[model samples]
Target: MSVVAVLRLPLAVDLSGFVKLLQRMQVPHRVSEEAGEQVLWVPDEISEDVRSLYARFPAGDPDQQLELPASGRTSTRPGFVQQLKASPITALVLLSSLIVAAVTLLGENLETLRWLTFLEFRVVGDYIQFTPLGDSLAAGQWWRLVTPMLVHFGFLHIAMNGMWYWELGRRIEARQGGINLLGLTLLFSLVSNFAQYVFSGATLFGGLSGVLYGLLGHCWIYQLLAPNPAYHLPRGVLVMMLVWLLLCLSGLVSLIGFGEIANAAHVGGLLVGCFTGLLGGLFARRKMAL
Candidate 1:
């Protein structure tokens, strides 16, 4: 049996130390086309033997890297700094903070620029009044297709979505590379978000929520179907999502209020994401078979 460890290396490598790792582990390995990544094959028969040897890896494959913002005090302690540099946790924290700051500073204007969390169809009244021009554009509006997603109604909305994107995006960027992540996000955003406005006859649309949820759904679905998602999602995530749905049903959470999780967009994005993941997995399998 073998457990494969895929590593997305830091910008800088401690060559001497990596050599020591290969010697210590006595395992076979291959470097990726880019010096930034590697794949290590580990022996299945082991009792936590790989923990120290493998903790250096970002996390899982395709989209698994450190949690971001690689934290804690790293040292001259050979190999220590190397691992910290690859942490996704540190990167995520920094990105979240930056987005929060930008959202906070943008003040009210953030709303007009991009849709935050709630879908345009969810908050139809306020949005319609807010963007009357969107009305003229609504009758078979083509530009709204892309513009709506860029318009957010609130600061937190952008922060939440942006933060997730920076973190998860980096991982997926590491995996399928930036091109695919960007492509998928754009595809899901345009297709699902636009579908909702069209279905509800919504003249005005706003927020990153639809796309945010789409990205989340994409990550969750891919992880579930693809073998791993960095770390497994706790039962808590499921319950939290359900509770959010219930809140939408109860009208307690606004966008998520009164069946407003863009149940349509949510379903559409989710279905798309699930199928995308399945399809992506098939591609991986075929590539392996080849």
Candidate 2:
């Protein structure tokens, strides 16, 4: 799309203004000189900002700035998610869950999958969540910590989380494995949720947010450690994450966006995710002797 800059007078500020704006926006724009027209393709976004800057011009041609992306072909989401969906991680998770469901349905005892477990609350001074039951060495009451990451809030929440999990989880799970993925999820959740309880002190926390932010953090830091802009990870996942963080932190989205966000959980998850990714990268580098 065309980014308009007010030239203040008899205007024609060549193409350099476009570059400055893109630098300001912190996104790269594709610039090309085609025919007689100078074209700049900013992401499908920042087109408005570019336009807003254009609108400031007076009634005359000033001259009219063109936003090529808005007028040209629209950009679409990266193909990475589609590629990832076809990967083994997605298939394995789906098949495993289905198999468990089928076995639960067909077993002699005939226990349903839903009966396996759910969050149970014990209201003492405040809220309490039942954690996953791991061996004593891992987490004594840890069962109380891990369950939230596995449990979804509702159908939409579950669906969205599942979509991201399947899409993102596959690449990361492939990189880290079931054990590491579970470990990150658990570690981030325990730290973030526990911190949330400490600060918010609301009690009875439940959700995948800690783990979600953990994944986001891992993706963010991973990109920096090994810039494989071409690999399985979408190049813009981290950028989109920053946008989400800005929206959440700004509270500009609270009215229309996801109503309830445990900010503490987000902060805690992000910190842990970045830390894990850094450690993971360091360990890998040492092993490879890089």
Candidate 3:
């Protein structure tokens, strides 16, 4: 676990391309600020290779071509932040979630909650009554279908979802483009929210867990079929999430005081995401062939 500095660069110079290169090469690394400069650290064993790569970085040779492992062509892609800015869909989804969570924290505010939730329901003594807000949808308040994805119930809920969304959504946006990520988010949210409503039987439930599961599923399947560095995920993460899903569905989470789990939403999101990933992966493979 000993990490050593492999390369040092001035702060003004962008390191995103270099970082992406390392990621593509499956090299473990960490970047830290030191002495008014950025230091790239890697395992001691890979330090020399990293140093050698830096010595002949593509920036130094305008005429030389940079060939990625799988592809023979060079890519003149911008850095990560610049790419994110160019495609703001992921940022929009993340910001919407944060804003919704903040507004929810203002108070119990039943009116606001009803507006944001996928479907409003009320308990009628022995039976649960459901209302699907037909008027709102007819009035072009179509945001209701997807708004539930942003309705985080607590601080931890929002924080976890935000982190996952930032990580997964950014990766998707960077590789597949903003529109693809936006479409996937919308599809996942719609399916998961509706599934939750159907299974939970007019109960109040809201969070991004379902969408996060969809992202996870998409990444997992895409990495499997496409085998790209951008979609890489640690095996442990996949195992942990799958185990947690099983635990939730098994009713163990509720017994353990984890509160109500949206098992159906998670299932629905994962299924839809897997389907999307399958289609996307096949298309990518065909495009590469072309």
Among all candidates shown, the one with the greatest TM-score: 3
lDDT leader:
3
Question: For model 1, how does the per-residue alpha-carbon lDDT over 36-83 read when each residue is reduced to its tens digit?
Answer: 543334433331233333444323222333233223534343254553
lDDT per model, in order?
Answer: 0.50, 0.54, 0.78
lDDT at residue 189 of model 2 (Cα atoms) = 70
Off by over 4 Å in 1: 3-143, 229-232, 255-261, 288-290
Clashes of each: 28, 13, 0
Error of 2 at 80 (Å): 15
| Superposed Cα RMSD, model 2 | 16.2
Query: TM-scores across all candidates?
Result: 0.54, 0.52, 0.68
Higher-TM-score candidate of 1 and 3:
3
